[model samples]
Target: MKNLLVSLADLPAFEEIIDVRTPLEFADDHIPGAINAPVLSNEERVIVGTLYKQDPFAATKLGAGLVAKNIGAHLASTFKDKPQNWRPLIYCWRGGKRSGSMATWLNLIGWKAWQLEGGYKAYRGQVLQLLETLPAASRFIVLAGHTGCGKTRLLHALAQNGAQTLDLEGLARHRGSVLGSFPATSQPSQKSFDSQLTRQLARFDPARPVFVEAESKRVGQIQLPASLMLAIRAADCILVQARFEDRIRFLCDDYASLFDYPANFKTRLSRLVETHGKVVLAHWNGLIDEGKKAELFAELISKHYDPAYKRSSQSNYLRLSDARPLLIDPSGDLNACARQLIVDFAA
Candidate 1:
């Protein structure tokens, strides 16, 4: 039993990883790549907790029975096909009885199962710590550009072509602007975002530069890691230049869903009232009502986004003055551009 425990570093040694916390706990967060085989249902957990406060002995008896029943259900379903030589790592919130009971049951049934030390809580601590240190040690290549220059598209292209790229906007599910929210998606909680960022960082090769877009402290409501933001500001930069007309077209296509729901689009535009003033807001809203998406996008870039980019890029990105210009074709051949960028930076 003493040898049946592993730390985070020992993760890759296991053939399978199981999260035995309640469903709600697993939904909140869990170890990356771990499968949920909860030892108690959400309601069962609540019931046991309430009973525990009143009678510890009764709670233990009830919890043990519940855990046994759940584990048996998992065996007859979730684990029924497992081979006898299966090696699994199991965890809960704190390597508590939930995980222990599961591990014990599996071991008794002749499967090799180890418990994760200090469970998800300990793993989360390491994730937070790594978020602080990893970005500081990384070399980032910041992609700087005005709105609708296909920075995100280029990021995807670079990724497909095998460049080490981090799409912060994709992770946050927001585009980093007042009107940046995805049409029907929501951003992850901060804790979940940290887990995602940390997972991406773990996959990076330190010897190569990571390609990321120039962003403010926040991407919509998601705050980037301070160290990463600092690293991006100080790192080498590439200015992605696109024709104004092409940009308007690109934004229209990229944000087509918002235009599909004009009322939603106008509501999003209203968020900029305080920043761009009512006169500008009213004009933008009028464009939405008039169904002039191209014209609306054009005005937005020239009036709002371009000016903001000029002001912020000059101040926020320390190396923008010396940034190398990557001219994307008017046809928007991002794959070709990505290939060139790979040779330029990731090489």
Candidate 2:
């Protein structure tokens, strides 16, 4: 505890980051690669707080005992295999007693452990402050297309080839459409989304343009940070062009899991009734009933997605007018297309 304090700026140099906050706090938002080893659990924290409000000295005695027991467990299990020279960065809420106690104990045990100076609060603040100007620093290349155009796939492909790509929907955990929900997977809280995105965005080189798929303000329930949204809207565009049939085929493959949860899919479709009207809904529902999803998908694209995309892109994006077309060939090789895009736009 003497001189064992570190700043958020030094986080990346450390091999391991340990979050000593409660499980819920860690789950809500944490440093991207941090491991959670809570010194005081959620229930224990509440109990200690209540006791301190009631009787300060007695609460300190009980909290000390609990902290010792928990640290023992962590040393025995979590830190059992650590070598003497293993360097770890530890943090808790507000860089208070919790993290201090853990760091002190680990240091006493001969491991080079340092407590985060302002803990998770400081880290969270750094993320917010970093985001304020970070989005403006990097240039963006928007992958613009209608539904089922495989923009996300191509984004990942670009990433695989070492081109900077931000998979927005991947971070949001939704596909950015009416039927965007993934099978049995729940999206993270907004704070968690922000943490992941801030970390992901920071990893990209500011000197290079980042590739990202076009999306609205919200991906499912997760909202994009305002600055990031503005940057994307103002960026250069790469219109991902494929045949209508190719898109439909992509949709069928991409969304095959939706059929497994037929009721959920139908419920999602129902939300669109106000826009498409009852007659169209009835016909689409009938198609679902008759098990003719390909026809339904094709109809939805032609009737719904195409027109909507054209209108929105024309109004919101400045670069769409002179958009460089990145073709999805007959082979449907998105990786090849992504490589070509990187090559074509290597400015």
Which 10 residues in a row give candidate 2 its minimum summed lDDT?
326-335
Error of 1 at 96 (Å): 0.9
Tell me the spans in candidate 2 whose CA falls farther than 4 Å from its real position. 1-3, 50-61, 110-112, 277-279, 332-334
- How do the residues 1-347 of candidate 1 rate in per-residue lDDT, one tens digit apiece? 54288899999888789999988888778887899999999999999999999999999999999999999999999999998889999999999888898998899889889999999999999998999898976789999999998788888999999899999999999999988998789898888889999989988888888999999999988889888888899999999888888899888888888868988888888877888898888888888878899999998998889888877789899999999987766665778888887887754
Q: Local error of candidate 2 at 289, Å?
A: 3.1
lDDT per residue for candidate 2 within 1-347, as digits (tens), equals 48388898898799899999999999999988899999889999899999999999999999989999999999999999998899999999899888888988988888889889998899888888877778888889999988887787788889998799889888888998888877789999998988888878878888777999888989999988889989989999988888889888888888888777667778889998889999998888878777776898999999888888877877888788889877776576767777877887776
RMSD to native for every prediction? 2.2, 2.5
Query: What's the lDDT for residue 124 in model 1?
Result: 94
The list of candidate 1 runs beyond 4 A from truth reads 1-3
